[model samples]
Target: MKTGKLVIGIFSIVLSVIIGFQSMIAGLGNTLSENGEAGGSGGFILGILMLVAGIVSIVQRSHRGNAPVIMFVIGGLLGLILAGSYSDLYIWSTVSLVFGAIILIFNIRNKKIAQQ
Candidate 1:
């Protein structure tokens, strides 16, 4: 469980970095476009949320409760919603969502093991 959390956390961080760079490139282009700035801003926000989720996952490696799980789920959903129009952003957002789902599964399995 700990290893799973660690791996996912690392993956999330790496994904965030990729998303950040991609978003900046996509967002900063054609400043004259009406939606360009909005998209870029959304992408940046998504990147920040991903970063926070990664840190939280790394710092809280225990299966103590649902806090971390909730955070992951929320972050993932928000990432999707705020992924902007970069198209590529959806890929990262989806990855983040998968990471969150994996963590949730880990938490559920851990709980079952504990109860047993």
Candidate 2:
């Protein structure tokens, strides 16, 4: 697997673990309320979505396809945007930018390898 993909996969796994643990500890409703200022079934659904996305991203890293990588990048970007818009925190946005840059670098490396 590419180094960038591996890093992103590991990060996603870690993020999933953190979010899952938080959900378990605080309950989805409370957690969402704390972070997003909203609560209820939607929060639970969002938590589930995050979990699924994290797992899928990790799994997709090992597969030989650009589509998954692209999706991962897009999802990460979206997450960052949402975080910034909703929470007014720029951390996720910065992280997302770095992650995207790393992925892009690895993609270029892969293309060069293929050409050679």
RMSD per model, one decimal? 2.1, 5.0
Model 1 alpha-carbon drift over 4 Å, by segment: none
Give per-residue CA lDDT, model 2, range 49-70, as digits (tens).
Answer: 4445445545656444554345
- Candidate 2: segments with Cα more than 4 A from true spot: 20-64, 84-89
User: How many residue pairs clash per model?
Assistant: 0, 0
Error of 1 at 22 (Å): 1.3
Model 1 alpha-carbon miss at residue 10, Å: 0.6
Question: Which lDDT tens digits does candidate 1 get at residues 14-59?
Answer: 8778878877877767365656335555666667777787788888
| Candidate 1, position 54, lDDT | 79
lDDT for 96 in candidate 2 is 42
lDDT of each: 0.72, 0.48
| lDDT of candidate model 2 versus the reference | 0.48
**Whose lDDT is greatest here?**
1
**Backbone clash tally for model 2?**
0
